[model samples]
Target: MSEETRDEPQEQSLFEAPPMAEQERMVEAILFATAEPVTIRELTGRMPHGSEPREALEHLRRRYEGRGVQVTRIGEAWAIRTAPDLGFLMRQEVVETRKLSRAAIETLAIIAYHQPVTRAEIEEIRGVGVSRGTIDQLIEMDWIRFGRRRMTPGRPVTFVVTETFLDHFALETARDLPGLSELRAAGLLDSRPPPGEGEEDAEGEEATDEGQEDLFEE
Candidate 1:
């Protein structure tokens, strides 16, 4: 009877998942196969029962430190991306179709830095009226999206940067945005005041400029 009892498979052991190292490999494989950043919930759903995806991700992230391709977090999701220093090697010339005008760039920057901001607030900060085309172009790029409406009168809609923006810039969160000096160094920001501040009509003209330089590139 004792022998039979011993021979009976333990319930816990039967349901036990693979070791952490193997789980790490599984997580690595999924992240490698997927192009979009994957959330922990998604990883857990795909992994076997009793698997711990969050723990596996921690192990995988630490293991990948200093590697050619490291695991990166974009907002709440994770992805394997080429190291920052090696990015230039991956760039290839492509036909320049459309680029962000100065108005669009400024508008995007405003939204990114002061997220969940209303159009009125954006105009207040920029000292110029934001053209509808500028907002449309940004939305079409999948960079910014409409956020919750304000509690104030008229319930103005707000704008905030998207996960795509975080993924494109390799940022974990909006707080990871560079400082003023860094923006200046990268030429993303200009010291001079925008060409047509306080003039509602001038921004409309700039919004139509397709030849302008693109600050955000895919």
Candidate 2:
């Protein structure tokens, strides 16, 4: 072999990924195109083999700081969303005029407050049977999803609030949710005594069964 060949450096491939700034742009594009929050692993799967998506994401997130739109992390996923302070600008565009039925509202509250909860547990809390339509509606809305099944006799499937639910409420996690007193003040919870409370009172009023209906009405 020639001495010149031995001294020569390896040629860089033309197809090599661009610089980190460019990679940040790629990450931004992918995040913008995706409807749901994406994980670092997912980003890596879609990006070039040698690309550093995590670093790119960090750069992108910093670049978006104080902008009208910001990059946010929900659990293990990342998403581009409106800046919290400027969210009012888009409120008119995203307002949901339709109201959820009382049953659906109550069910959602129960699931949010006690996640990984089973149907029986929710029924036990609300003092009424949870209808199929209610659970189906929450699932259809993508606010709540099926979680792992319990280890008990029936091995019943559990329910949990989705990231969408947290985002809708502008919460980073379930722990950010308001306390029970705050919920009552916001009219999200009823003032009535909780289920199983009157069972021990000999003179307590009988518990009434509130009929469960469709998740939404009108």
Candidate 3:
């Protein structure tokens, strides 16, 4: 076999995988195009074999540092998101403000404060039956989600605030939520009774199930 023929295979190997810089660009493009965060394994699957997506992602992340857009990690996934400082710019451009109904707002606040709470618990807290539409509205807004069922009789499904809710409020965790005093000070909560005051039992009047009460203690 000729030397040139042997060298042909060597040359082909050099171009088999993209360079690190090109890989970084590829990662950036994928992250930019995706609406949801992409995991390293997902990126590797999408890239050519031997491409170092993890390293490339690190490079891309550093390149975006201090910029208007940044590569951020959510759980095990990565996504290109607006920089924290510049999020207001995008909010101003793209956010459409929508007013929530009083019922929906109250339900959302209750869920946020007492998450992994059962529908029955919510009714007990508000001293009124929670309408299906209110829960549906919050779910449609992606602010609340269904949690695991309680171990009690009938095993009713529970509800909790979603990560989207935390992100929208710029909260790292549920604990970051303001205290009752703060909510009252902000006028989000009122000291006076709601419209139908005498309808239901007072707060904590309904006994809490043993295991269900500690769901959010963590």
lDDT of 1: 0.78
Superposed model 3: Cα runs more than 4 Å off: 1-20, 50-55, 170-218
Maximum-TM-score candidate:
1
- Per-residue lDDT of 49-82 in model 1, one digit per residue for the tens? 8899999999999998998999999999999999
* Model 2 residue 209 lDDT score: 22
Question: Which candidate's lDDT is highest?
Answer: 1
Worst 10 residues of 3 by lDDT: 204-213
Backbone clashes per model, in order? 0, 0, 0
How much is 69 displaced in model 2, in angstroms?
Answer: 0.7
Of the candidates numbered 1 and 3, which has the greater lDDT value? 1
Instruction: Give one digit per residue, the lDDT tens place, for model 2 in 53-147.
Output: 99999999999999999888876789999887876577568434444445667678778778989989988887777778878888998889999
Give the true-structure RMSD of model 3: 8.8
